[model samples]
Target: MKEVRLPTIPEIVIILGAFLALVFSFTLFLDLPIQLALFISWFFVIILGVRLGHSYQDLQKSIMDGITNGLEAVLILVSVGALIGTWIAGGVVPTLIYYGLEFIHPSIFLLATLIICSIMSIATGTSWGTVGTAGIAMIAIGEGLGMPLPLVAGAVLSGAYFGDKLSPLSDSTVLASSLSKVDILRHVRAMMVLSIPAFVITAILFTLTGFVYGGRNIDTEKVEFFKTSLQQYFDIGILMLIPAVIVVVLLALKKPSMPVIVIGALLGAIWASVFQGIDFADAINIAYKGFAIDTGVAFMDGILNRGGIVGMLDTLVVIIFGLGFGGLLEKLGVLKVIIATFEKKLTSAGNVTLSTLIVAFLGNVLGCAMYVSLILTPKIMEDSYDRLRLDRRILSRNTEVGGTLTSGMVPWSDNGIYMAGILGISTFSYLPFMWLSFVALGLALIYGYTGKFIWYVDENSPSDETEYKGEKVANDY
Candidate 1:
């Protein structure tokens, strides 16, 4: 293995500057696709590696290694594609939308959307699943209700990420906890100190927004027509929901996400045949090509006409290229060098904790993988926390809050791209309203500045005791 060293600040600025400029041009002047933009970004990182004395072959391997980091997510995109196809084909999606319009009042729909998605996401411990299934339906309902797509997308994302950040079942949460050596419960509790207020504030904002927008004023004749079309096209019944219910059970049992979602797709396909009377061959075909819904209603057609194995192709391309860029950055030690510079200034618990957020969030944005942030932030902050006498739980909490929340904000991130594609909103359009990210970031900065809950080194250190105003503190972890 080649030895990697800390990069100078100028090097960091050059690399980041080039990547950002390219991305901005793609979005602003060129109007190229995200995948293409990311592909170009990967080339920039590869060039950086080559400039740093790495071989072309080594950079090539670094790209592949970065791509490897997202293989699991790639598989998930495939399964979710199939799941969407089969679920809608089996009337599972229609059932949710149908019942939703009936029971979920339009005026309160935004608030309702946030609350239900939060509960479902937390229960399943998988944001993608919650978003893919329930989120798809929520967006459809938003369209049916005439609400702004970005607002609805923001509400849904905030709620979905809430569970993804705090739930022990969430991979990000587990990775952050395990990496920092904090018990899962302690990690969750420490996070709740900030997350609770965030959630409450978010819910209130959504509620207030909901009251102002009151979807009841919009004509629902089209949405009602959609439900009517669903009834006439196939057998819409309770049995169609079994697939979603089974997924809930499997998730509660701690089953792996890939198989659980695949099972849901399989069961949905089966239901399409047995109950909905779809031809067996056709049901299987839907899983591959997605359900083609062409109702005269444009909004309904848009909602139902999604999800198949092939549907994920565009997203897979973006993820591959994005990960390649992130991977190259990691292999070249760009991010580590930046973290090293930050570490040089850590003088107190507040400074260390606060700096950890900056490093972790930057890792999420620049690294393009939440896992990378969860891994790299802790590795870089380990010494600083010990020196400041902060508990590992604080590190764990900061890691997840920053890592999980920021991924969905960046337009090219794996999560961000997937969500924008699914919700049919631009990543930037919905980012502002993702209240969880805002609240979490705000609260982290507050904790960082105020020094509340900040622990100190032990006063009994024979040699180092005099360096810090150390005191006996209660164990938080």
Candidate 2:
């Protein structure tokens, strides 16, 4: 057996600098596929690891561990692709679009998209569910209303993530609270200090943006074409919404997301065969290959022609490579080395808070999952907070800021890939419109610097008394 050695500071810099340069230049500036960039980065990091005396077998194990950790997210992405395909074939998505195009005014469409997605996410406690269902419908509605797809994508992501960070049912939220040993409800309360203001400001920005689009001359012809085309293709009606309703209800009841999504897909397949008159063979084909139709309306065709299991392949590539790269970095002791460096510099409450936030963000960037960040941040930073007498809930809130909020913006991340794949817009294109994230991140920094909302441990209280005063029950929306 061989012992692994940690890289020195300069060595860590060389590794991280090369990886970040490769990722950003290729994906952001060069406009190449993220998978390619991640692959190259992976190779570069492995070489550095070998040069530092680690064995190839050990490095391989690290990559595997990273990928293994994220397999559930990978599964969810695959399931979502199938769900979207089947739901579209079954008329569930079209019905939502039809109703949305009919009732949601252009003046409030962007604002409404944010608010509706926020509410749905809160209820379901899952951002992916809200995005895959309502997010899809809103993008189409925005297109019909002649709004820019990227702008709409921004609103959809903002709203989806807002609920995801705050909702008790949200996996990231629960993970953050449990990791800190803070009660989930108390964590939620502490988070509201940062999240609510960001939510309100984002909603306001969307409202103003919506009004700008509202005052423009609408292409009534295009809206009519979409509505008519949908009516011509599928049985658009109230009952078509049943599968979507079931998803929200079941998830709200605390059902696991993967099975609930698969159930939705199955119901959609049944509805496609029964109501839409799609044959059994065609339904199966749609589930795998996605729904397709020649609506003759180019815009309509673009929006409707998506979904299926295969549709997620491109996203899966990025996830696999990204996770592998992240895992390799961990194996090479990049995270540990970096944390040790930061620990020496922790001089004040503000510095500790800021460093914790940076580490949390790096966890998502390097680890490829908020779950990884949520787990790693607290396990590493809890002592730092305690050293300063800062409440651990403050640490939990920062995790949501750096980990959960920023996850959607990284091109190779699961949320980022899923959003781009589902909305048919590039992550970079909508990155500017993720107002809530930008604002929340900014507010977190300010609070850290100014010491606002930074709670302290009550010295007079028992050391074991950390849980909030209330009945310990499962958190709801």
Candidate 3:
């Protein structure tokens, strides 16, 4: 076995800079596809790995490792694609949109969208699922209500991630807790210190923003057009929501997402067959190729014509290529070298927490895999936290604040691309309205600097109580 060579800071910078430049040049200025940019980046990283004295086979293994790590996410994306297609065909989504337009007042539409998505995400413990299902319907409803699509997308994303961050059933939450060696409940409690305040602020903002559309009289013509177009095609009723309810209930029971989503897709197909009058074969085909509509209403067609396994192909390519690039960086020790530079700056509690956040943010941006950031940042910073006599729960919370919260804002990230694709809004367009994440970042820094929620660990006493600043504090973990 050839010994792997570790990259120096300067070498890592060159590699990262080149990759970023290529990505920006291709996707931004050149109007080229992101997948092609990522593919080229992957090749560039492999070459750099070889230059660092690693064998081609070793680089290949690293790329495969990165790709394998994200296969579950890829599968979820595929399932979501199928679910969207079938749900649209089954009349579930159209029904939701129709009802949303009828009952949800334009003044409170954005706020309603936020709350509805938050509840759905909390129940299912999957933000992607929430976005793919309820988020789609909300987007259409926003359009019919004459609301800005980007604003609605932002509200939905904020609510989805807020629920996802707090829910114990969430994969990112579980992973962060487990990686930090903190009990899940303890981790959740720790997270609330930052999450709650941010969520409250976000809700308030959404509520205020809702009035901008609410004050204006809703375009009854647009609403009637969408409703009439939808009713003309298929049966839109409350019962169509059965498949969605079942999926939510099953997922809430802690069933694995993959099989549950598949079942949801199947149920949608069944609903389409029995309720919407679509043939079983055609429904399945819709799941594979997506639903098609020629309602003569261009806006309606744009909203309804989406989904299918095929729709996920571009996203899959980006993920695969991004992961491969990230994997090569990981295996070549590039990330470790870069992160070590940040570690040296953790001289105090505030700095420690802040540095952890920075590392996690960098991981999300550079690694492209959300899970990688959640895992790697904490793993690398664990010893630092221990050395600082800080509780691991703090470490976990900051890691999530930096990773999961920020993942959807980065254009090339797994969460970012998935969300942009599903919600039909550009990441940049909705990014400013991702209020929870932005607020949480500021709150975390304040908490760290003010020592408000920073808990200290005493190795001398393993008990759940410690004396700090002349007061006995409960360890809480």
Give me the candidate number with maximum lDDT.
Answer: 3
Candidate ranking under TM-score, highest first, comes to: 3, 2, 1
Q: How much is the lDDT of residue 254 in candidate 2?
A: 81
Model 3 bad stretches (over 4 Å): 1-4, 461-474
Worst lDDT 10-window in candidate 1: 461-470
Winner by TM-score between candidate 3 and candidate 1? 3
Per-residue CA lDDT of model 3 for 1-477, tens digit only, reads 656678888888888898889877987899898778778787778887888889999889988988887677788878989998999999999999889988998888888988998998888888987898899999998888878889899999998998888888788888888778777777889998888889889888988989866747568887898888889997999899999999888988889887898899999999999998989999999999998988898877877788899988887887787777767777887756765777777778889878888888887787776877886777778778888888878889999999899999989878888899888789999998888889999999999989989998777645222222223444763
Better structure of 2 and 3 per lDDT: 3
Which residue pairs overlap in candidate 1's backbone? none
Model 1 C-alpha lDDT per residue in residues 1-477, reported as the tens digit of each score: 555454578987987987778777886788887677767777777766776778889889988887786577788778888888999888898888888877788778988898888888877787877788889888988877878889999889988988776677777787788777666766788888888889999989999998888765556796787678878876777777888899888887889878888998998899899888889899989989989966777767777788898888877786677667766777777766776776767886667667787878787677655656666777777767776666666777778777788888877667877788788788999988898788888787778779765444454533122221233324543
lDDT of 2 by residue, 181-223 (tens): 7788788988898999999999999999999987375688989
Cα RMSD for candidates in order: 4.3, 3.3, 3.7
Local error of candidate 2 at 358, Å?
Answer: 2.0
Clashes counted in candidate 3 amount to 1
Which 10-residue window in model 3 sums to the lowest lDDT? Answer: 463-472
